[model samples]
Target chain A: MEFSLIDRIRERTAQARDDVRLGIGDDAALLAVPAGQELAVAIDTLVEGVHFPRGTAAADIGWKALAVNLSDLAAMGATPAWALLALTLPNADADFIDGLATGFAQLAQPYRLALVGGDTTRGALTISVAVHGFVPAGKALTRTGAQVGDLVMVTGTLGDAAAGLRLVQQGGQDDPRSAWLIERLNRPVPRIAAGLALRDCASACIDVSDGLLADLGHICAAGAVGAQIDASLLPRSSALLDWFDDDASLDFALSGGDDYELCFTVSPQKLAATQAELARLGCGATRIGRIVAGEGVCVRDRDGRQRATARPGWDHFAA
Target chain B: MEFSLIDRIRERTAQARDDVRLGIGDDAALLAVPAGQELAVAIDTLVEGVHFPRGTAAADIGWKALAVNLSDLAAMGATPAWALLALTLPNADADFIDGLATGFAQLAQPYRLALVGGDTTRGALTISVAVHGFVPAGKALTRTGAQVGDLVMVTGTLGDAAAGLRLVQQGGQDDPRSAWLIERLNRPVPRIAAGLALRDCASACIDVSDGLLADLGHICAAGAVGAQIDASLLPRSSALLDWFDDDASLDFALSGGDDYELCFTVSPQKLAATQAELARLGCGATRIGRIVAGEGVCVRDRDGRQRATARPGWDHFAA
Candidate 1:
């Protein structure tokens, strides 16, 4: 049998790079990691009906599969480079492969990310992507560096993707606001530029993949420091606000996931510089909270009282 | 939700390497690539009832997941160093996770391949592993270099795994020979030492995952050359010959896949040295055929007449 699916993907995502000595054909890929750089690697698998809704567009699935992994690199402040895809399909459908490749290339072209190697197997529709990026020695951002006095911040709006998912699930995609929310759910923009600007200055950084509370909880756990965030300070997209009341939108923003926005902590002295750098990149940043001495994340209302989200953060194995 | 599964894996596969600046529990792993070394990366996905039979033990699944990827590195003549696992399961069962982690670490510890990062999600059982290795710049093996007149060789016996699967399918596993064949199927040894020995000597190399004909066909297709092999000289384990007739065993050896042995081509002058070096490593090499001028693989009987096999190599998408 001809694996023309691979052929089509190769044709579609074909990219030329000096560092890729061998890409997508041999027993494995041969890549030249630039001298004085550390390799940042991340892998993620998206299963139909679990990671995405049951009938998400193939293009959207392809774009989101790569975007989430790139978001991981963004959290590390790594410059995206090469990727390996292990895509599982229910069958060998050429059109699906075409759509997936088109969306994948659309996201990859801007970053000069090369699709180095991949394997296609017959199974449930699932895509696993392993991305490798470069970060200068000792400069790669991590989740273990938050200090007691660092200010916590997030890039872009948070609740849009989650609200989009809710809108789609509820069949609420009739108006422009719903369309924007659904787009957020389908194609999240990875903050690669903002992350690069945060390197060496951000005390700790993580992409709000599992929502602000849960992912920020990770930074707190890793750093042994707590964070106190003012819920009212979260930047909400106008489209999200149009569909839901402030309280509902805030709940989604606080506990909903799939945002792909960078949530980071930085020293107060460097806060202005970090914000300005991100501003120049056009990604922008919003101050939401600050690191404290205790453990776990604390969410406060506009009146400075503790608030509880209606839903916990997204968990893969949640009952 | 408790993602204690990750903690379980972290405890079981905790390996220390100075190069792994940060391993699991991070947004992306930070790994130091040795200076002047090119990185070799490969990814493969195995799905239940496709790559392996249904109800296969989690440990075997985990072992084969990493083993097949290591075979790719072995084919490239690279030193295995790090891996990222993306496992999809129907549910997060502790016993299953334990078995999988144990099996993964069993193979990983020997090569010091750190489990750098992973993602687990709910779905039909599927495991995708991306393995990264290192080779001196310009020394990595590839399939595009086989020249006409190069001796085609393989390390270890082939078709045992395929035959073993056949026995299990036929419910023929009641004796020691059956047990041995099943073991071959479950835990195919990757020829890392033999491949490393091939280094600059072998003109081209490929792992025999999709059978000898299909995989050798890759080398031929990649090099625009053909190959001719004598069926009588094809290596088979004693247990395979004991269970099946000569003709059937030959067919299995030629077209049946899942054999992780290495198939390579070396110039006639270096053949003796390559064999002797592999012998020092106790892996042993067998000269099975020669690269010829043309395309595709040709099998010959002892009397030198072209022979045809009943089955083609394994195609994941084949119906």
Candidate 2:
């Protein structure tokens, strides 16, 4: 039965890749990273209730599980290559497995990523995925390269997923805008192309999983710099702006997490080129702030007055 | 608090290696798999109640989690290099994290394996580890190389861990031999040296995570061959033999799981050399069977008559 489920997954995710010498069904997988590239590896786990709503669809869970890890790779400017999934299920529900495989394949096929190997066990429902990707040696972006005077930019809009989560928690699934917001919450688009474009231009890069204020704070802390953003400058989707008032929408963008967009820093001289490159890729970059020589992230209004926040971002343990 | 916990783990598991360009602190880890080597990757997840008893020590859980993954690498004759650990806990238990880190570092330090990156979240206790290793291209031991007329051998002893599990489950924790048995169950040694020794000569190799019969059956199926084993010749540790009667001990050796020993096949000409190499490594090897021309595994009694069994090994979904 376990073999059948594994076979089902393998058949669904079958992609012919020459680098994957030995994939699923083996005790371990053999992979060949092209000769001059460094391997970037990341792993993330999503518990049923903590990561998604209790009754979330199995397909969404599968897609998001792989999406989160791919986001990590995206943050590092790595091209996705392969993934390993460790699925803990409450029982041997074949339908759940089939739905999950379908969801995983949907995301993986676009990146040409192969599902190499993994383990399935009986337990509370949980999904863990580890992704391996490749980046040219010395070219991977990191959080420690943000320099003073660099322009702080982000790809795509923020706060949509967090708002989506709020609507879901408030039982607003029937709302007309819920589908769009929930889609943002459930199936985040990892900015792989933006990251690849930023490889040569961005000084520092990070994905916005933990909200704008918090994730940008990570870049500041890592690079020994500070950042200031105009509260009026945060990019918001039309749905977000239409759903909430000014302060509430800005707050969601500031402190609410799970955006999965790329928050990066580029030198002033490279900003135009970076924006043009991203525009060509169809996800235009939005400049929101600039790096300064301070210790933490700060936000200001149009009047140049500082704004205060209770917390900059979400911490799982703190919650 | 999350950063502090991560800091504690990083400080404890730090090992300076040139290939580890970035470790632990970034969105993803950057590793350089040496040129001309293939990367071997494997992942495993162990849940609280399903993998161990409710009150098992955090340290033991940590050791076993890494041991299982390392055993997979050993099966492929790959040298361990780096690891990523995703730890899920019910809460922010500092003491548990500390103990777990200590246990993980204890096993990892000997191999110089660095804990490169991972994620932590709130959930039922689960430890998912993805390990990456390096093997010379074309040198990995796999299950498809076994041929007819090859000798079937196993390293260390089989059934000790299963016997240990039985004792623990039966409330015999305080038995005179309980400590020995429980140790086997909690911390089975991965035969890295034995695998390295057999790399050039072993026709096929696999780690016995399932029972001897079940795991060997996988080899037979993969290699398109059959296997015949003399049940009486199966190896049993003195501790296992002294605790159970002949039939029970033999049963455990045949179908009991959780023994992380290597079961491999070698051509008849390589038998003496393989045994000598393993003996030099201090684990030694025992010849219990031979690869044959049929399709499934068969067990024989002293009179060379085949014996039938209902099932071969444990399956997580089936259980």
Candidate 3:
């Protein structure tokens, strides 16, 4: 039954491309790389419980599965070229599987990422996707390039997705604005163009899948420097403020996860040029922090004093 | 806790090449690709009950998890390049995770597949890996490449892995070769080199993950051709005979899966060249079948007579 079910899905897809050289039957699939380009690769896993609710909407599950993987490629400053999906479903539902595939095809078409190969089997519901993108040799974005005295910047507003999760947990009624926030939670837009644009000017960059503080800590750690983010400089969306009380507002921005925005550092010398470049791309850049000579991350209010507490972020194995 | 865990792992490994551009602690890792190569990517998932036993050795589970995805790249005729591992352990087991990493690093050393990025989370026992490889453009192997009348060939021997699984499940006493076959069951070496060797010669290719009949049926369906497999020519290891009597022996050879071997088709004119290439690589190739002009797969015995059977191969969800 599993074999037939897989066969049905495979039957509907196109066979291996002429250039594929090898496809879904052997120990591996092969591809012919065109001359003069390096492959950009990324992998992400969506477990039923860890990444999503057990009984969430199947369509949204499929959407987020592809979205996160694309987010990784975006962080690399590469244009998504191809993807392979590995799915484990508890039961054979032709409709559900088809719908999932439909969602993937729709998302991929916009990015021009072809679905090349994969494997399927019966198990707890899990989805893992590996994406391949192409970039000119030596052009990818990395986390180690930042230098001391670099200005920090981010895309999109923080804490909205986290706020949306709270609303869903609290059973927020179906209001239009809440729906938009929920949409942000379920369907994150990978900043592909923004990443491509920042490839040259940004010294070091990363996507804010983790909280702003935690994700920025990564940049500072990798670049061998300290960072100071001014709390006053943090961007807040009115929707988030409306949803959270004063005390919770800061917490949401500081500790929230699942915000697929880009946080990057550029040389202080490039500050003017950086703003000009970002404005050309029609995205605003906020100076939230600067890289310093020492290590560890520090946060200060407008008055410019350090406030210390336990680490603020999500941990997979948190008790 | 997760941040510290990542920091520890990063510290343990030496810094990567200058081309790494960026490393851990960022939202995404960055890389610089050398000029003139295309990337091949694949992903695989191992669930507790579906892919392996609930209590399989942790080391073996880790080994198989990466090996399976590596096999997918091998089938594509690409050189292994990089990998991202997403692990969902019930809880952090420093020793177990270390062992798993060791298993993966050991296999990867031979192929030079760099462990670049991944995420860890708490959930049911599951391991998902996405592997990326590189090939020249238009050189990837695909299931749709088979032409009418291509000679079908397989690597190494079949049925050994199946017999090994039976030994493990039934708790049989040790045979001289028990360890050998059990190892094969636990860690099937993907035909990485053999796959690359055949890139220029084979028209269509696939890995024998499912039973030979079922997997080959995929090639036929994808290539829009029929197949005739010579049952007598199918490679049967001597170790396989110990598990089943005469009647059931055929079943193991035909339907027993998990060989992790390559099954591919070459033109008759190229068969000699392909065989010579395999010999040069110290690999084995068995001429077990031929692609035909019609639909469905047929089996032929020593006398060249077709055999009739009510069923063929293992079906995961078979009632």
Tens-digit lDDT track for model 3 on B208-250?
7777887788889888999999888888876776656654556
How well is each residue in B10-68 modelled by candidate 2, as lDDT tens digits? 67777799999998888899999898899999998898877777777888888899999
In terms of TM-score, the best-performing candidate is 2
Give TM-score values for chain A, per-prediction: 0.97, 0.97, 0.89
Per-residue lDDT of model 1, residues A278-303, tens digit only:
88899879999899999998899999
Per-candidate DockQ values are 0.83, 0.84, 0.45
RMSD of each: 1.5, 1.3, 3.8
Worst window of 10 by summed lDDT in candidate 1 chain B: B1-10
Best by DockQ: 2
The native-contact fractions of the candidates, in order shown, are: 0.99, 0.91, 0.53
Clashing pairs in 1: none
| Decreasing DockQ order of the candidates | 2, 1, 3
lDDT of 1 at B249: 91
lDDT of 1: 0.89
Candidate 2 residues lying further than 4 Å off, grouped into runs, are B1-5
lDDT of each: 0.89, 0.88, 0.74
What's the distance in Å from true for residue B73, model 3?
3.4
